[model samples]
Target: MESNYHTLKRNYNQLIVITHLTQLLTYITGFGGLVVPLIIWATQKDRVEEMDAHGKSILNFQLSILIYSIISIPLILVFGLGIITLILIAILAFVMPIVNAIKASNGELPSYPLSLNFVS
Candidate 1:
């Protein structure tokens, strides 16, 4: 099977930014986080060749965070702890992604805890 690869040099930077923003968006935009990146990822998927290995790593890491948040928020709500649970998740969501981006920029691929591999 063929793999989808990003092919834009600037896009690698964009992916890094998008990844960071998407993670923050889970808390800031409340749902837009999932939407924007999913759309970008879908559009950018076919051009992975444009994306450098660093870019691919960032993309995969971001994808993992995004999918995890998508699944976790609803599950956290199912617990019904009222905003607090969400707030905590949001906090983690913010922190972890930032760390990932930093690590990515430093040429390290950080494995997100409980993240599913959405970018392959």
Candidate 2:
């Protein structure tokens, strides 16, 4: 029983890492950033409490980024500010996920600044 519990715990930890890192998929699928984490969270949330919490955090972060990007679209008319906003968003999308994944791997809850609670 103890071994089973250990295995379960290890699996949960792996899921947490995945829940954060999977956002990188957005670079390829163009939309997988949110979809992949959503799928994993939806499926594993009930099975593991950690997956549920981390999944929500990841989803909320992605949703917040999406909202910010959408709002920046109109800035294109204002001295090309939208271009800069988009570039920053791109960089954030790339860097933040890896940072969060590191935190997850270390058994810490990762929080994203500017992330709105869209899932919770």
User: What is candidate 2's lDDT per residue for 1-120, written digit by digit as tens?
Assistant: 999998888888888888888899999989998998999999998998578888888988999999999988999887689989999999998999999899988888887888998777
Q: For residues 62-108, what per-residue lDDT tens digits would candidate 1 score against the true structure? A: 56655555666667568755356546656666777678667655545
In model 1, which runs have C-alpha deviations exceeding 4 angstroms? 1-11, 49-85, 116-120
lDDT of 2 at 33: 86
Kindly report which residue pairs in candidate 1 clash with one another.
5-47, 5-48, 5-49, 6-47, 6-48, 6-50, 6-51, 7-47, 7-50, 8-50
Candidate 2: give the clashing pairs.
none
Best by TM-score: 2
Cα-based TM-score, every candidate: 0.54, 0.92
Candidate 2 has its poorest 10 consecutive residues by lDDT at: 48-57
Q: What is the lDDT of residue 100 in candidate 2?
A: 87
lDDT of each: 0.57, 0.88
